[model samples]
Target: MNQQALVDVAAVSAPCQGALHWVGMEQIALPLRVAGQTIAGRAAAGVNLVDPLARGIHMSRLYLALAGLDNQELSLVRVASVLETFLESHRELSNAAFLDLSGEALLNRPALISPLSGWKTYPFTLRCRRDEHGLQAILELTVGYSSTCPCSAALARQLIQQAFDERFTDTPVTHDGVREWLGGEQGIVATPHSQRSQAHLSIRLANGLDDLPLAAFVDRIESALGTALQTAVKRIDEQAFALANGQNLMFCEDAARRLHQALRGQAGIEGFRLRVVHAESLHAHDAVARSEWNWAGS
Candidate 1:
């Protein structure tokens, strides 16, 4: 039996001829090494099809070129090399190449007041575009923490004062009794409302910088907020977290400003944008704020 040769249908001329702004594959499953960790990532690879008369691009070649990302750790320099390879593979057909790789970055975070440690997964994305002029790269990630409302804390303190006055109106106060009451829920009649909040950070890397600084970004944002969410905790750790929340109270606007200042100080960042989301426990809707810096003509 004679086997029919495989047909290269993508290479044939299109019945309706037109150039495409972007043509390639997306959601391609691939394992990527980034900042010393192997991540399961999805890559969206594409290039501008410049030849209007040409049938179509070689999609398989674009897919095959993504293999370059698997062998080396992900960095701007390495990503630029991969994009160069993509353009080379599609030589006459494309002048620009784009790659977007997204995945969860896992890290071991220790408890605030205990020796226990657990893993935290941060959703991260790396995007790069390469053209004749040069390569532009950006990194994005989300860090979740606890946000305590300053207004709510003050209101809570007022309520606790009222409760204390009502309870101790005639009764003589004793040190041991007061201590016991403080240890119990009766001592603090109300508590400030706190909610799970997240900071979405997107930073454009300097043209000459190659380091991603994923962990550094996370550390800075969490340190600014002062109430990073814990993965594993003991009773002491929970108490410590509560103390942190009490000490570092903030609103959505406060969180956004803090992140803006922190990101602006990073050396690797040329331009940046941030969005802070506080899932309000007191209200039905979420509180949100956004900030951007150094993004003008470029």
Candidate 2:
């Protein structure tokens, strides 16, 4: 059997001063698990090889170490450990290390009425870094939700009322007559537009620890938002979705504010950044708002 040859690339050159140095690899694929589910993700791994004299780092070691990770043992905690390993393995060349993982997390959710459930995929990013001071980690989650236009609902109500007043001026005003008028063409009005929305939430941990339950955090956000979009739906599920849409009417700003409040109230969150984007159905442009929890000063 022909064995793969190992090369030593950590050769040092002349030392330099007052320069920020970084050395590592990117787009390294690894098997990972969050909440007991196996997933394949790509991580951009790096470390601050501050040794001004070092030629480069052991890039192959980083890939080999990550490739040995097992699904059963993969978690945020494991990720942080791997980062530590990367730093320690290159101790001669660097004193700091960073790892970034990007991939989709699939979650199965039950429908409102139907007994069947479906999977929803969310984009997720996990990052960890270590330095002389300590370690820091961040979890980024992306969620998709539906937004309804409150203004349109109000306008629709007003148009129906106006149509009723005009059509029933000469005849007796009755519930059936009003319903018919509201359902007719004159009562049908151009509704204000609301669109499907998405939010990117990032939470920073106080320590370098990454033991938080990512899947559970995502579930909490999904539940707080009431309804999440799905890949597959039956008739019953569709009707239930319509009901949910009618009940939860929110503007772009309203959604952002709500998420801000929710994240602020969540336990174990030291710092957070929230960004909400609404793809408007009425206009060509999108509306976005961002909020960040300032922990450095406060």
Candidate 3:
């Protein structure tokens, strides 16, 4: 006699009720690729499963769908597509879905006046929403740069001038003499405070094109703000940094406005929100400014 094979299937439960909320599946890890580089990311997903009668949602499907993602094909487009898939898989229960991807993006930067190079990592985030209208994508990028306090720089200059005056009261001190005095043990009386700064930029894209040169954008921002952070520093690099700080002395407001201008002029950016935070070395609190651009026509 032939034995019958047993088949098992999950029992379908009743639908849930009005305005049910389902939130979980935080910190799901996956590999991603952006701007031609592969990076690891932990994506968080949440959705509102609204069924008038069901007891719970199918949580395992969300993890399985995210785990099935291919790192090589990971892009803004892919992310949005996956989010839609998540919504559709539970279309009967969920009316909207929200997905967020967080990870570190690395880049190689060359040192100033030196042949050496180093790597820099910036935190990146991308969020998407699936609703009745369609899909919307948002890109958030964080970049680090250096900022010199304008007040400190001015004070340093004043102190240097006073030192020169004190040294050459009887006779005018030559440039060499001033340089020597400033380079001596008591030469330059004071130095300005420069601190590592961070800029958080969030852009709303019209499409799912994640191919934007995020690293290059970061470089442009650092250069536009006039203070690219240094990984490996030598004497020359330090001098170069001092000069940069002196020239690009800016307050937190100025930095935010400058970043806003850059983002507004950048092509393919429909709209953007910029937040610049300068960690002040002189004080315990940080200075921050925020700016937003509205692209009505686009």
Q: Which has the greatest lDDT?
A: 1
Per-residue lDDT of candidate 1, residues 164-259 (tens digit): 887778888888877887778888988999999999988888889776778888888899889999999999999999999999999999999988
Q: Write the per-residue lDDT of candidate 3 for residues 179-239, one digit (tens) a residue.
A: 7777896778888898889999888876646654576678678878988888877788878
Local distance difference test scores for all models:
0.89, 0.75, 0.78
List candidate 1 stretches off by more than 4 Å: 1-6
How good is model 2 by TM-score? 0.86
In candidate 3, position 272 carries an lDDT of 84
In candidate 3, where is summed lDDT lowest over 10 consecutive residues? 8-17
Clashing pairs for model 3 are 15-53, 15-54, 16-51, 16-52, 16-53, 16-54, 17-51, 17-52, 17-53
Residue-level lDDT for 4 in candidate 3: 88
- Judging by TM-score, tell me the better candidate of 1 and 2: 1
Error of 2 at 286 (Å): 0.5
Q: Per-prediction TM-score, please?
A: 0.94, 0.86, 0.86
Q: Where does model 3 exceed 4 Å of error?
A: 1-16, 21-24, 208-212, 295-298
Q: Could you tell which candidate, 2 or 3, scores higher by lDDT?
A: 3
Index of the highest-TM-score prediction? 1
